[model samples]
Target: MAVQSPSLDDPRVLVDTPAAIVDAIPPYAPRSEREAEFYALGDGQMLLNIGPHHPATHGVLRIVLKIEGERIVDLDPVLGYLHRGVEKLAENADYHHSIAYTDPLEYVSSLFNELAPVMAFERLLDLRVPRRAEYLRVLSCELLRVSSHILFMGFMALDMGGLTPILYSFIERDEMVDMLAALTGQRMLFNYMRIGGVNGDLNHEFLSRLGDWMSRAGRQAEAISTLLNENEIFVKRTRGLGAISRGQALNLGLTGPNLRACGVPFDVRRAHPYSVYPELDFDVVTADEGDTYARYLVRVEEIKQSIRIIDQVLHEMPDGPVMARIPRRITPPPGRAWAAIESPRGQYGCYAMSDGTDQPYRFRIHDPSFVNLQALVPILPGCLIADTMAVNASLDPIMGGVDK
Candidate 1:
C-alpha cells in the first residue's frame, strides 16, 4: 500500500512526501532560467540555443534566444570562436609583409583584404600607382567581388536545400580561381597586392582569355538569376523575412549591400570613389525592401555591375609599370593613416600606425562583417527557426572577418 502525498496547500500534512517518493516524482524545476525569469518578470519566456556548429550560423556563430512561445523576447549572439589575434599579429609584421596576413582575414574576399592594407600603405608612403596598375587593381578587385558573390550564391542556395546551384556557380568560380591563379600563382590567397602596387601584370594572352571567360561568366550569371530569382518558393521564403528598416540599419552602422538593400544608394565605390571606380560607369543597386530577398537581389545585380566594370577596365587598360616607385625595403616616416575599399562583403578599412620602421607600430582592420553581425540581434527575433538560417546566409557574414 502507498500513501498519497498531501498538496502543499494542505496545512494538516507537515511532511509533503518522503525523500524516496519525492525522488520518484518528476522534478518541478523550471524548463530553463529564461522560463523562470519570464515568470518572475511576468514576460512568459523560454531560452533556446540555436547553434555554434549550425550550417546557417555562418561559421561557428551561436545565438542565445529568449522566446515567448514562437516569438523572440531577446537575442544574444555569441562569437569569438574564430578569433586569432590578427590585429596583434599585424603589429609585428613589416608593412609590406603584412599583405600575406590580411589575405586570410576575410578568406572569402582575400583579394580586397590585401587591397585595403596595400592601399593604406600606399597612402602612408604617398606613392602614386601608375594608371595601368590602378586599372589592374580595379579589374582584379571587381572580378574578385563577383567570384566571392558566386560562392555566396552557391552556399546560400545550399543552405536553402538546393545543391544544383552550388555546382553550377562553382563552375564559374573555378574559372575565376584559375584566372586569379594564372595572374598571382595562387588560387585563394593570392597575396597579389604589395605596398606600392600589384605583384604582377596581365599578359596579352591572359587578358584575351579573361575577356572570353567574362563573356561566358555573364551568360552563366543570367542562367543562375533565372533559376533562383523567379522561383516562387525562394521568393516566398526570402520576401519580408528578416527585414531591417532603414533607420535600424543606419543606426547599426551597416554598409554595403546590407545598407543598400534598405534603399540607400550608399556604395563606397560610388560615394567614396577609390581606385578606378570614379572612372567606371556602373549603377549602385538598391532595393526598397530590406529583407533577405533584397540582399539576394543586390548581390545578383552587383555581379552584373562587376562584369561591366571589368569589361571597361580591360578595354581601357594601358601599358605601364605595375609597381609604383618605392624603396624595396619600405619604411615610411612615423605616421598614421586610414584607407578603406569596397570589398565584396562591404566597406573594409585598414588603419595603420607606422613607427618609421619596416614593421607597423599598430595595425587595425575595420572589418564590415563585424559591424553587420550586430544587425543580427535586432532582425533575428520574431523569425522562425528555419528562417534563422536563411537570414544568416543572406547577410553573408564571413566568420573570419567577424572573429578577426
Candidate 2:
C-alpha cells in the first residue's frame, strides 16, 4: 500500500516532489531584528495579513497586522511589490530623455514629476525658462493638484463603503483629464515637460476646454462634497479615527497635505518659492484637527485655492515663447543640482548629478509617498481592524511613488 500524503492545509508537511513544489508549506523564520521583534507575539495575539493584494491597503502593498482581540498591536508594511528600478533607468538615459522616466513615479500627477527633473536640469545647464513657460508650468501643476484631490475624496469614501462618491469623482475627474489631453496628447503618462520648457504651447482647443471646465468644476465638487461632508456616518467614522499628532507627523517625515493637515503649513511653494509661485497670490491651506476628517477637508479647501491660482494665471499669463533656446543634446557641467516642487501629494524633488556628459551620472528622486507612508506605522496601532482602510485612504499615497 502506498503511503498517503499530508493534507494541503498542513504547511509543515514538506516533500521533495514536483506536486508539493506547486503547493508547498513555506516555513516562517525571522530575517532581521525588526522582524523578530514584530513577530514576537504572546498568548491570544495573532498575525493578520492585509495585503500585497487587498483593496484597503491600496496598490499592491502587503501589511502584516499583529492584533490582540479587536485591537491592533502592530503592523509591518512590506514594500517593493511595484518597484521597477526607475532610478537605474534614468541614470542610463540622456538628460533630454531622462524626464520621461519620472512620469510613472507618481502617475496621477505626471506633470509635477516632469517639473522636478526639468527644473533640476535647468539648474545644471544654467538656463532660464521663458516667462510664459513658467506661468504655464504653474497652471498645469495647479490643475493636476485639483484633479488629484478630487480622486482622493472619491477613494476615501469608497474605502468607507460609499460607492456613489467614486462615481461622481470619475465624472468630474474625466472632464479635467480631457482638458489636460487637449494640452498634451497623452491622458495618463504625459511626457510633456522638456528640459527647459513644455512640449507644446497652449492652443485654442485647450483654452476652450479649460474655460468650460472652470465654469462647472467648483459647482461639481461642491455637489459631491454634500454627499460626504454632512453625512452622519462619514463624519463619525472618520473624525478622530486616526489622529496623527503634529509631533508624530514631524517625526515620521510626513509632507504635503498630510503635514499641512496637522497645522504645520510647510509647503515647498510658500517656503522655498519655486517657479512662478511667488508671483501668484494664494494662501497655503491647512487644518488644525490632524485626523482623517481634517485631511479630507484640507484637500477640499485646496481645490478652491488651486482654482484661484488658475484664474490668476489666465489673467496674468504673459506673451512670449514657451521653450527656451537649448541644444538638442543637453550636457550639463560637472556638478549636482536639486529641484523641489509642490506636487499634488506634497514636495516632489529631484537631484541630478552631472560629469560633463549628456546623461546624468546619478538621478535621485525624493517622492512624498515614500516618507508619508511611515505615518501609518505610528498611527495604526491601537485602532480597530475595521478602521484600517479609513485611515489608509486618508493618507492618499500613490504606491507607484512609494515603491519607486
Model 2 misplaced stretches (Cα beyond 4 Å): 1-29
Candidate No. with top TM-score: 2
Separately for all candidates shown, the number of backbone clashes (residues 3 or more apart, or on different chains) is 0, 1
Stretches > 4 Å off in candidate 1? 1-44
Error of 2 at 344 (Å): 1.4
Q: How accurate is candidate 2 locally (lDDT)?
A: 0.87
Q: Alpha-carbon error at 240 in model 2, in Å?
A: 0.7
**lDDT by residue for model 1 (345-397), tens:** 78899998888989988888999999998887779878876676788888889
TM-score of each: 0.88, 0.94
Which residue pairs overlap in candidate 2's backbone? Answer: 51-62
